[model samples]
Target: MQKLFKSSHNAAGALLVALGLCQATPVIASETWHWHGFVAQGLMRSADSNFVNNDGAISAELTEFGLNSTWKLSNTVRLAGQLMYLDGGNRFQQGGRIDYLFLNWTAINDMDWQLDLYAGRYKNNHWLYSATRDVAITRPLIVLPQSVYFDAFRDIAVGSDGLAVTSTHNLNFGELELNWSLGATPIPKEQSQRVISTFINGKTEQDFVHQFSVFLRPAQSKSQWGISLLDSDFNYRRVANDIFADGDFTVQRVMANWRYSEQDWELSSEVFQERVSVYGFYAPGTERTQFGWGAYLLGSYNLSAQSTLYLSHDHFFANKDDKRGYLLPQQSGGLIPAYFGYQRDTALGLSHNIQPNLRLKMEYHWNTGTGRLGPNVVPDTVVNRSRHHELWAVQLMYWF
Candidate 1:
């Protein structure tokens, strides 16, 4: 992994230079093509031994760079894509990776109705920040709400290789946007280990993962509200024999989002409910079910054109039915602690625009419980456990 990290750093340098040149190059055709890119570096540290990543100490692992481009072939056709390199501790993949590549076609383009069809690896558009979360400058915090944006499946939930159709209707009041996507993507081994090992006590390899989503947003004035239905189906194969079983895992998620932005202040909130089901894993006649719920409330104020301040509160439950985790001790044979059932986080964030193309960001998080921490990175044992902790992060980003 260290060697891979070194190689990724070298590649990132070269890509940065190339992206800078591309951004500087003028567009030959006025309305045909455009290119832009960004580079961000950050430092994060937590005051605990829990596994946010590698001992949870101060680390210089937060680095990302990307190049995005669009080619407008005609009035109704365009090719849009992004190539990105990301390494953000254990929350995401550590080395170079292709983020998204897609083609978009507009079948109906008019003032009242618009339809778009996309194929290839398309970005997830349901969540409030899913579309642009990869770019550091666009996010309001170092980490988005973990309840909705669980880090264990960060890569898995970001994009899918399939098809999507988006439709927009212009109304007298505001507008409505509807999107539907379906596809499958492969899960990396490391990600599988991080998420699966805690629940299943054996070595597992992903067989196939399927994803589907439907989102609808209605907007009026300066406020927009949306509801999304998302589904993920995962199957695993046993590599080495152990106590855990090889079977199917399915997750169904329903999320509601609302945002209001006007004048100098913005308020946003999202609530999600996730249902998890497992089949043929523990026993032949066994069926297990659990439901998890989470929500976040965020408000931001623009002090000036170049500076902004924001605060957010986020909370999550591993099992809403057993919020206290008393049943968890019995369920896991007393190996896991009760506090693993829930987590609550409060954050204060501020961002300052140093220049038109450069920005600085700082944030602090006061967190309770480790219910959602990556298990592989942070073992579920008392020796490495801390129920309460604080995290501080600083980032600098530049884009052109």
Candidate 2:
């Protein structure tokens, strides 16, 4: 009835329920219940902020609390839920969204094939790294690999309200998992109430996001590969330096990943090509076209039974029109801004198990890039070295 859609928190709650961890169900036979959660805290000392000047600030913070509890509905059915409370220098927000909610049905157990339906609000499965979109619980490091586009989760990454089906079939080698999903993006009520919301170029924000991908395990224990394709069309109205007016785009994403993981180390590389163009915008009179290519590499090492460390780098190049294709003109760095540029991020992480479930981690990060403003931004041009930034964080985490 109303366009006022659900919030990220609501979507997260549904995710928890769908995951079979937290659900509303009737009583059954002798019940088995278990609870799982994590508590983490950290202090970050930055040289750029308090360390430098106009650089950054020094503050000690943590994820605060991220916990979950799950119930078994049946051997095949389950009810699960998770709660998260967070405060930090990066996440810079309070409250947690549902991690997952829906029923996972296995069409055929004996075979290597299975089917799943995720209803309600859920995260977009655009890339292998999208699953770790959580603020403080999933990653011990302060920031994820930027080249993978994990930085734009939610803000730009598209999630939806629909069903996704995944099938895993075995071949001569390892196995192949193919997935397909169709859905729509979220629309806030305030935007709908407006005579014309600047967000989208249409009367309603209900378009389809279709995605497909395949994962291949070439080597049993050493090598693996993945190929992904995602296409989405949205009615958008963006304005910044000038005005995007209105337009719909068919965005195509091609991703390929190769990795070698063994008993003690993991080396992985990912390459992607994104081709997007406007079928048509709401704008009656305008012209636009955008395209780009990006790539990154990640490596990890198991130092000991208690310690592990890793590093990664990612970069992107685009044309003037491609730079303007972002949902928000301001976010895309103000349209036709610049062409040849990239983002470089370096991080070092160490996780040592103090005792059983208690662990300690220390991470250092150097991020340099240029957007326009806001949060860990680098710079668009070399002369603007003032925009270069540095970040540092140390944390303690425990799970039970």
Candidate 3:
């Protein structure tokens, strides 16, 4: 069943690639077609933890390659797509995947307002950096703050397959933008093991994800503020002699974000509250629900025309009521450590433009707690034995 599911998607991806290439030959000299791609490689290491490798060895797992194109079918319609290959070690699944392939229609355009609609596999534009997260050069750091952009949920949160709509209004006080999306993503076998548990032999499927967001740019200001809401559902079916039973899960979230920019510096922040409910996963007829909250603040300054420095502080808690994590060990009969209930980190980074189309980036992190690690549902205490850890990474990237 899993093989069939994967092969079908792979076949679709191959078809899209073929169409793009075959059509490009005929329209190569036309202004209506455009394409771009990027490649990046990095070395990363984690100390006193298994974040990158079990033995704390230097690893070359941070790799990304992508190609994307846009072809204008008509004045009001266009076709856009991206294909990517990624290997981020323990962060998420590895190999090739279709990031997004969609038809965009400019439904309305006027002096006062504009509207756009997307169908097929559409990108998630609700989050602050979600739309550009796949491109290494567009990100602020080698690793984003895990409190909000948890790596474990990268594939599931990146995008969805369905429909989306966006509308923008130029108002008297400011500009307002509204977005809505409804869709779901397929969860592959490797992702299931990384997100749920390594011991389980089962299939996990995302039922649906519904999201909405609104942003306001106050008149004559260099800042923007936005708010978003999301609701998603998932189900799991166990195979023979599996460690876990059939289960259902639901997640709901509300987030507020703000960004400010100046000639030489920038500031951004986001805070969110999430609620998760689980049924029949750990045991039959068992149910549990928890509310968690997280936030991050980031600031960057231009050191020179070709270099920049940045810093960030991030925090997350599994249960808002138990911020210190004392209750976690007690509830698990001391089998789970307190650190597993929360995670906090401070990061410092630097980026330098080696040339117009090439860049180098380096970053270091001081971290506490293992709450953000995966197989998140089960908590791998045996491998992530330490509560305090340090990580550093360096990468070089090129684009065309």
Q: Pick the candidate with the highest lDDT.
A: 3
Better of 2 and 3 by lDDT: 3
Q: Who wins the TM-score comparison?
A: 3
Runs of candidate 3 with Cα error greater than 4 angstroms are 1-8, 19-29
Q: lDDT by residue for model 2 over 220-257, one digit each (tens)?
A: 55787888888775555454642335555566778897
Residue 79 shift from truth in candidate 3, angstroms: 1.0
Could you tell me the lDDT of residue 144 within candidate 3? Answer: 94
lDDT of 3 at 65: 86
Ten contiguous residues with the weakest lDDT in model 3: 20-29
The superposed Cα distance between candidate 3 and the true structure at residue 106, in angstroms, equals 0.6
Candidate 2 local lDDT, residue 134: 51
Better of 1 and 3 by lDDT: 3
Candidate 3, residues 1-400, lDDT tens digits: the string is 2222232477659756864522111324366777777889999999677678678889999998887777789999988888888998888688988888788999999998999999877889999999878789899988999988988788888888888999999999999999999888888888888877878789999888999999999999999999999999899998889888899999999999999999999999999999989999898999999999999999999999999999999999988988878998898899889898899999999999999888999999999998888777888888889989999999999887
TM-score of 1: 0.87
Off by over 4 Å in 1: 1-30, 49-51, 198-220, 282-286, 376-379, 382-384
Ranking by TM-score: 3, 1, 2
